[model samples]
Target: MSGSEDLLELAVETAREAGRMLVDKRPVDGPDVVQTKSSPTDVVTQMDRAAERLIVERIRAARPDDAFLGEEGGTSAGVSGVRWVIDPIDGTVNYLYDLPDWAVSIAAEVDGVAVAGVVEMPRRGETCTALRGGGALLRSATGARDLQVNAAVPLGQALVATGFGYAAERRARQAEVLTGVLPRVRDIRRGGSCCVDMCSLAAGRVDAYYERGVQAWDVAAGSLIVEEAGGLVGGLHGAPAGPEITIAAGPGTFEALHDLLAPLDPARD
Candidate 1:
């Protein structure tokens, strides 16, 4: 963690570069290219590829021996212990719709642990960065400031944010789960970007967040930011977070929120 600041800088730089590429290529109505992945709802566009290529190109140029994993592209092995995990465009649908919630996320992991993370929302002109031990910070045209979640907020009054997977079955299950969760909390917001949701929690914009079937690149950086911002993160049923499910919140609401969602755990679905 102490040695992670440099890596954090690198991640921030990479995210900024990738974010600019996405903004420059912002689709006018719709992007030039669009492709389906596992389903019709899950789509990718030329901007995703272009941004990922730009990000990978920058990281590969700087750290040739470092491994890389990206949402648009697959994995690239390297000798360096540092592995750069990336999401060129975190909210593809948002980007496609020209929504302001999309972002570029990048994280640096050493020995399978995230040491530094960065998320950039180009349209919002917002950047969130964090190192393993260092604190989380959010930057905008206004200025930069340290990030801290509103841990004192009670679970009942907390504003929760979440996202559903693209699969129809998964969406259906998540909807049912939300039906139960909505009445228990203040309200729920369906933000399109995972990084944005996590960073928003870090900035005290949201009280809690959880999602199932999140890709590694989706939460990698954002989780670190949450942790550094005095928040807790865990997977479904106290398991380590992965592609299954992830829940993040301040210490006060973590357990209570987790307990409430345990019955609806997507891992069980």
Candidate 2:
């Protein structure tokens, strides 16, 4: 069986390759839309599928027995304990618009627990990676550096990062929830990508992050990055971070945001 570091190495290599492919083949006019899901604003692009295929094929060649859960491709079962959770393009809308906030996120889960993860932002020219117990690191053109979340920031002074759902109803409820969250914090940033926001939190670019209606593929890699960076990533009322809602922040900031968000019931769509 492969070790955690081995999985992390594969994730990093695959993510970097996928990021390169997406960037190189990107059309000057933008990518072609494959279709939309859940809502019209929730889109899938041809590059999304190509990236997922490339990632899965590359990893499967090295670890054929492993499973997969991809955002573009659905779940595929395997006998091996390792299962890859991937978001080929975490911010398709941003990518479609030629924005730089999109990312290629991949996480290797052993027996349902993510042991290693990578979130590669090609446009930003940075990659974030973490192993089970290993600390998170950010790699860029200049060099690489270990990542750490901001110190225990009070909720009132926290600069929170977040994203909205694609559906109109969910967006409406999220906006309502934000009305409560906006005034309580120092300010808010809607970054358009969950993995980017989580990585931003890990790199101390943002004090905290919270979002509703995110899938496992969205947070699987980024959450591990945050936790490994000496932060907390979870749901409200002691739940694990998942689709209902996911929040991440440093020590005091996590609890403060959690307590503040619990009453708002941001989970409701």
Candidate 3:
């Protein structure tokens, strides 16, 4: 297999491994297994640590020289040829609550540009994959199939997905923007996971998704999936998404959403 093919295979395998661990560990009766990370609301659990270890170990074994950046474990040095970004569990809060919206996200960056990605929703048995030049895929037990964004809805009449930031100040800003946007759009949802939110947008389940105070690992995989699926993924200003934040929308709705969010001035208002 080619280099991209190899990365794709590893991403899918590692994600599935993590997903299995998450699905198998739910409690029948007891308090959830949770602990504070950065804060009380910023939660982590045994499954998160185990999943990150599994993903890191697999990638290290397969490509010993490739760099790694994960949500739980922070960053590690590696050769410059390739870097793997992993989010072992994207929606830990939901997962702890026994919600079905969590996912394992993985992406490969070549020379700092994402070339391939995989987002696996364990409970739903859905795996969304994408390559830089190749199109996107929605995989399930039924079969593997191509995916694309739907552009039928206008910007004002479309549903949008978003999430709150971990910090109080950032969350306040997000609320401010929501105040401006809610009345103008069809609807808005806070789905608890930026990775899954972006994938849902890519799959045309929602018209757009934008959020501030997100890490690169949260959206790296999903952003590429959106772009490869014929959607636009970028910053709130409609520029290329970076390590800072993400703003993604379908072709039909991106421009208007960008305009609506510009006043927030994520950098300086």
Candidate 4:
């Protein structure tokens, strides 16, 4: 059986390889088959499927007994007591428009807990990796640096990052939640990539992050990165982060934001 550190290495390597494939497959003029899911604004491309295939292929080769739950591909069972949660093109809209926020995310879960995660943002020219209890690290053109959330920033002056859902109604309700939470913070940033936004929080590039109706693949990798970086991850109202909502922040900032937005939680609303 592979150890957590080994699994972490495998996750990072696979994510980076998939990221390079995505970058090469990216179109200069227009992406092929710009498809939509859930809403018109939500997008996907041929590259998304291809990248997922590559990741699944590689992971299967390494750990044939492990399970998989991919954004592009549905769940597949295995007997290895491990499951891989992956998002081939995390920010497909950004990738379609040739923006820099898109990423390839992969996370490994042992039993039911995330033990390793990797997010490779080719356009951003950085890769983030985290191992449970080991900590998170960011690698770029310069070098690698340990990640840590900014605990010093107070709620009023915090620069929070976030993403929206695919449904118009969800987006509308999210907008309402934002307005309520926005005035209490320094400002807002909508990067269109949940994986990137959460990694930014891990790197302390942003003070916090929150989103609703996110799937397991969406936050599986990024949320682990945040937790390993000394940040907090949970639902809007002390519940655990799941499909409902994902809220991440530094120690003090986490408490403040959760309190401010708990009322906006869709499950409760």
Candidate 5:
């Protein structure tokens, strides 16, 4: 089996390469739309496909036997038991609007478990990385520093971040859940990017994050980072973080937020 450090190195390098490609190719007016998925507003751009291709190609060149699960390219089975989960652009809306919350996310799984992860935000000039047991860190022009979630913040004082789905029905449900969550917390932020939101939690930029309709590629890297940074990342009903829901936060805030969200049925749509 390949070591976690080896996988992390590849994840970080590929993420950085994809990030640079995305930044250089992003047009001033935004990328050309390829097609829509779950909704008309849930768009996929040419850059999204191109970036996924680049990342898959680079990783394949280094380890041809490894499998892949990409947001844009979908999945390809392999025999190596190491799979790369990738989101070429985690915040497509922000990237399209020239916002700074977009990122390239990559996580390497060994035998169906994430062991290494990377999230690269080119616009923010930041890269977050983690190994399953090693811990998480943020790297930028300034330097590299270990990351940690803000300690056990009370639920009411927690600055929470969350995202909504593209479908109107889902959005409405999410909004309904928010009506209950907003008044209880310090404030709510809709960053429109799961990886960015999770990275923010790891970096102490947000006290917690939860979203109802995220995919594996969206949270794979960010969740690992949060876990390594001393935060809990999970779903409702004692489930692992998946489409049903994903929530991340420090100690006290995690349980409080979970209990609060559970009663609200944030997963319902």
Candidate 6:
């Protein structure tokens, strides 16, 4: 297998293992299995911990010298060759509420660029994977199929997806951008999961997606999937993606949407 192929296989395995753990142990009722991270509103749960442990363990076993950065557990440094970025459960709140939109996201970054990625939605039985120069895939028990974003959406008629940030100040800014764009778009959806939102854009379920104050793990895997699927991934200001924020959309609508969001200015506003 090629290098990308090997990374893709590892990503698929890690994501599926994490997804299985989440599906089997997700909290359905009672008080949520919750713990605070950066703040009270930024929560983690038993499912998140279990899934992260599984993914970290698997990646460590496969490549013991590589570093890891995970949502629930924080970071571990290692050799500089490869870094695995993992968000074991991308929608902890949704999962805790018995919602089916959460995912297990994993990405292998080589020299700071994600080369292989996987996002596994256990409840949906869908595993989306992408290799840097290859393409994206939507795999399930049903079958595996190549994936791509829609190329025909017009700026005025596009459907968009987004999420709210945990911080009140950031949420206020995001709301302002939403208010500006909501009236011009065909529709807007707040699905509570960044990974799923990007995947939806990749699969043509939505035409655009944007968010602020997201961690690397939340968007790393999904961003690559969107790009490999023939979409454009960037920051809200139309800059290249970094470790903390993301904005992505179909080819036809990305520029227009970027222009509309430029006034919000995530860096200075």
> How does each model score on lDDT?
0.88, 0.94, 0.83, 0.88, 0.94, 0.84
lDDT of 6 by residue, 206-259 (tens): 999888777889999999999999999887554677544577987768888888
Q: Which parts of model 6 are misplaced by more than 4 Å?
A: 28-32, 236-238, 243-245, 266-269
Relative to the unseen true structure, what is the C-alpha lDDT of residue 152 in candidate 4, on a scale of 0 to 100? 60
Candidate 4 lDDT trough over 10 residues, lowest sum = 260-269
Task: Please state every model's RMSD to the true fold in angstroms.
Answer: 1.5, 1.2, 2.0, 1.6, 1.2, 1.8
At residue 19, candidate 4 shows an lDDT of 88
Displacement of residue 20 (Cα, Å) in model 1 is 1.4
> What C-alpha root-mean-square deviation, in Å, does candidate 6 show against the real structure?
1.8
> For residues 32-148, what per-residue lDDT tens digits would candidate 4 score against the true structure?
865788887777788988899999999999999999999986479999999999999888888888889999999999998999999999998999999999899999999999999
Task: Please identify model 1 stretches exceeding 4 Å from their true place.
Answer: 1-3
* Model 4 accuracy (lDDT, Cα): 0.88
Over 187-212, each residue of candidate 3 has an lDDT whose tens digit, in order, gives 99888988888888888899988777
What digit string (tens of lDDT, one per residue) describes model 1 on residues 75-188?
799898989999999999999988899999999999999989999998999999988888999999999999998885777899999998888888888888899899899999
Model 6 poorest 10 in a row by lDDT: 25-34
> How displaced is residue 141 in candidate 2, in Å?
1.2
Task: Check candidate 3 and list the clashing pairs.
Answer: none
Candidate 6, residue 213: Cα displacement in angstroms equals 1.1
- Cα error, residue 258 of model 5, in Å, equals 0.5
- How many Å off is the CA of 235 in candidate 5? 1.1
Question: Could you give candidate 2's per-residue lDDT for residues 101-178 as a string of tens digits?
Answer: 999999999999999999999999999999988889999999999999997898888999999988999999999999
Q: The CA-based lDDT of model 1 is what? A: 0.88
Tens-place lDDT per residue, model 5, 145-200, is 99999979998899999999999999999999999999999999898889999999
TM-score of each: 0.96, 0.98, 0.93, 0.95, 0.98, 0.93
What ranges in model 3 sit over 4 Å off?
A: 29-35, 266-269
Candidate 4: clashing residue pairs, number: 0
By lDDT: ranked, best first: 2, 5, 4, 1, 6, 3
